[model samples]
Target: MKTDSQLQQDVMAELRWEPAVHATQIGVEVEDGVVTLAGEVSSHVEKWNAERAAQRVNGIRGLAVELEVKLGALDKRTDVDIAQSARNILSWTGSLPEDAVKVLVEQGWLTLSGEVEWQFQREDAAESLRSLPGLTGVSNQIGIKPSPSATVVKAEIEATLRRSAAADAKAIGVEVHGTSVTLTGAVHSWAERDSATRSAWGSPGVRKVIDKMSLVY
Candidate 1:
């Protein structure tokens, strides 16, 4: 296991290596395995990139992001403009159905609410606006429409986990309650844990995923 100081250093180095994040404009602090990022970035994309870069560090167990977005004069846009642009972008995204997502922009923050059949579609709706100028943050409340039959959701998740190429697939346990799924197990790395969760979400009718899985490293 890496000490907190060592983990902090590795995270800092990762932030530097990531081209999207301005490492010098961000502060890193570690306690136990939790990393706290504080500072400011020029765009919402930079803040998101910094968070992703920190998560790529192996020993990081959690993140507390206090980074602020300071938009420049040219990057600033009215809430109405941002909302219109978001709507146009979502409409242009082939993966998302037209009018499937509702956008609300307030003080440069965008909140998305709607329903889709697949988890990937919900993700695609949010990813479509990550780099939009004048955006501060995004709250994706887009839901996955539950399957008609909940009885087979658990079984389908189990089959996928067993069939997936993930090395720890068999070690993970699946539990279903209505449209929600709970995954419990231990994996060798963050990658395996994420893969296991993704497999669970791939099932039909899984509106919420409770990941109880942990990293063994």
Candidate 2:
């Protein structure tokens, strides 16, 4: 097992390796296995990429991002313009339903609220708005509309996990209560853990997925 300092170095190196990130401007700190990213970037996309780069590193049990988006003068768009751009992008997104997402902008921060039939739709909406110029942050308040029938949530989730080819599918426990799922197990890497969580969320009628799984390495 790598020590906390070793893990911290690995994460810093990973950040530097990512082309989208300005690694020198970002500060990385590790305690135990948790990573905290602190600094300011020129764009929201850079901040998001930095977080993803850190999460890709092994031994990262948790991540707390304190990075801020410090937009330049040319990148600064009015709140009205940001809202229009957000709406336009959501409209152009083929996966999302028209008029399903409601946008509210305040001081360059955007908040999206609405209900979608699936989790992917909710995610897609936020992703479409993440790279918008002049945006300081995004809050995805969109929720999933529960299916009328949840009789087979547990079975379906298990089947999906198995189909995903997760390394420890059998070891992962799936517990369903109402439309919520709680996953418990130990995986060898972050990829397996994310796969298991996505499988749970993909299952129909799953409004919430609580990932209690941990990394064995």
Candidate 3:
């Protein structure tokens, strides 16, 4: 286990190492393995990058982001412009179905809502718009259309975990309730936890994934 001060230092160092993030603009505070990030960032992408960089550090039990996005003069745009840009970008994205996702913008924040057949498509829709100028944040309300039985979804996720090198299949437990899958167990690292969740999302008809797995350092 790492002391709170050590964890904070490590997170700050990791933020500096990430090229996309402006390390100086962000403040990292750690208390009992929980990290709180507070400060201001120029763009939504930079803010997202900073969060990921902090998560890369070991011994983080939880994270709370208080960072605010303040767009520069050159990056600022009206809500209409942001919405149009979001629509155009989504249209050009080959992975997403045409008009499958609806975009609404308010005060530079973009919200996407609709239904897609696969989890990847839902994710791709939101990712495609993260780089839009003047965007403060994104709310991905897109849902997945369920198609498989709960038993089959559970089986597929278990098989995927077993096949993945990053995750320990035997140590993880999978449970399915309707279209939602719950993962409970202990993972060796953040990478393993991500792998386990990804495996669950890969199964067809999985609308939601609940991660109850703990990271064991």
Candidate 4:
């Protein structure tokens, strides 16, 4: 069995390689298989990233997560604040109906799950969650499909891409079901692909953008 320090070091190593964690700080203390993370991060997303990073490394009794959040931004949130804000955002957003959605917070990270009407609701849910205090990241594992007009949804997605992407929204094919948009085809680079997705996400009614775009290596 690895010593606490050894396991902690391994966990840190894992976080260093993770693709998601940025714009924050992390500290660790280990005793036996128990791991505790300390320090202040900019967003709940980063905090969640740090914790998930620790879990992905393995060899731990449990996570004793002690993380502080930077105030003002939509990331740092207390448990009560997230619970209230979640209720508020979902109530206003009209994407996910009430009672169907749920939000859970641990150390400021907001975990969301439920059924929603539009794909954009899923994305909006993430955005709403991302803005709450102490929200490190949102686990948007929501399902879509309320069986509305698919054509109108696709047109809305295209219009949204036109407003946000600004480069080649016409070329970008959008398949929308409720609020979800699946973008298939090729783009110039990763940045462009992300930009396209951002456009879709920016739209008020859009929920999720499955960017299955390819780039030439």
TM-score of every model? 0.96, 0.96, 0.98, 0.46
List model 2 lDDT by residue over 1-217, tens digit each: 8878998899899999999999999998888888999999999889999988998998888899999899999999999999999999999999998899999999999999988888888889999899899999999989888754555888888888878875577889998888788999889888899899888888755788898887898
Clash-forming residue pairs, model 2: none
lDDT of 3 by residue, 1-217 (tens): 8999999999999999999998999999988899999999999999999989988887899999999999889989999999988999999999988889999999999999999999999889988888888999999999999758988898899999999999999999999999999999899887888899999999877999999998898
lDDT of 1 at 26: 99
Report the error of model 3 at residue 2, Å.
1.1
Q: Model 1 clash pairs? A: none
lDDT of 1 by residue, 1-217 (tens): 9999999999999999999989999999999899999999999999999998998889778899999999999999999999999999999999998899999999999999989998888889999999999999999999998674656887888888888786466788888888889999888776777788888778866799998888778
lDDT of 4 at 175: 78
Which of the two, 1 or 2, has more lDDT? 1
RMSD over all Cα atoms, model 1:
1.2
Comparing 1 with 4 on TM-score, the higher-scoring candidate is 1
Model 1 lDDT at residue 24: 99
**Predictions: Cα RMSD each:** 1.2, 1.2, 0.8, 10.7
What ranking emerges by TM-score with the best candidate at the front?
A: 3, 2, 1, 4
**Candidate 4 wrong stretches, greater than 4 Å:** 1-40, 45-81, 94-96, 146-184, 189-191, 195-210
Model 4 Cα lDDT, one tens digit per residue, 138-211: 67787654443668667665776677643467667777766677887766544566678776665445556687
